[model samples]
Target: MKKILIAHDGSKSSDKALRKAFELAGKFGSSVTVISVIPELYLTELMDIDRARILETLTGETTRTMEKIKASVKDVRTVRTMIRQGNPASEILDAAKKMKADLIITGSQGRHGAEKFLLGSVSSKLVDYAECSVLVVK
Candidate 1:
């Protein structure tokens, strides 16, 4: 694969996916783009006025997490980091298409039944919408 996109959320599942991406990249010498999505919605009781501050906090956290991943990976291959504000699934799919990715890797919490339906799993949505091959790591 020329380009591989991985959705990362700084979780163990995502860490597994990153390792898988590293393995594939090593095999094919593919460049990897790591994406972290920050949802824009606040809690029902949260004030809109504080949205900017909250978003700033979230962005900083995400950036730090990506940086940690980069450091741990240790120049394994070409890596690009992205932090986006929006629905995770849609943004990931859009990025994959825009980047012309041949493969996508993402983490799954492995939800079930009502919880999966109500929450709309990002990994599930990505598999449904992505044009390229999607690997959902458990």
Candidate 2:
């Protein structure tokens, strides 16, 4: 692919996906964009102060994750890193569309049983809704 979009959250699964992206980039001379999203709950759920604190903390973590992603793809010539606050699937899809990525890659957590039922997987959601081609790595 000429343009690749990778969704990362600093998890091992995401790390693997990142490595795969780099491999593809190395092979085909593709440009990759890495994105990390911090879930932002509904605004009315918490007081303004509490919301600020949570956002601040998550923002810090987002920064760290983005930095790590940057380091991982440092040798790649056309890699970019970004941080967004929202639902992971939505953010990823939006970014892919914005970047006009030919391929979208993400990691699968493989949450089964009750966990899968309770909290829908981001990868699955993206596969269902994303307009571009997606690769969900294990």
- For TM-score, the strongest prediction is 1
Measured on C-alpha atoms, candidate 1 has an lDDT of: 0.84
Query: Candidate 2 — worst ten consecutive residues by lDDT sum?
Result: 110-119
Deviation in Å, model 1, residue 49 alpha carbon: 3.3
User: What is the Cα-based lDDT of residue 20 in candidate 1?
Assistant: 92
Q: In candidate 1, what are the lDDT values of residues 1-138, reduced to their tens digit?
A: 799999987766788889999988888989999999998675877787787789888899999999988887753579999999898888999999999999999877532324533423888898888999998875
Model 2, range 36-117, lDDT digits (tens) per residue? 8888778797999999999999899879878767776654679888888888889999999988999999887622323523
Q: What lDDT is reached at residue 21 by model 1?
A: 92
Model 1 stretches with alpha carbons more than 4 Å out: 42-44, 110-120
Instruction: Indicate the residue-level lDDT of 127 in model 1.
Output: 83
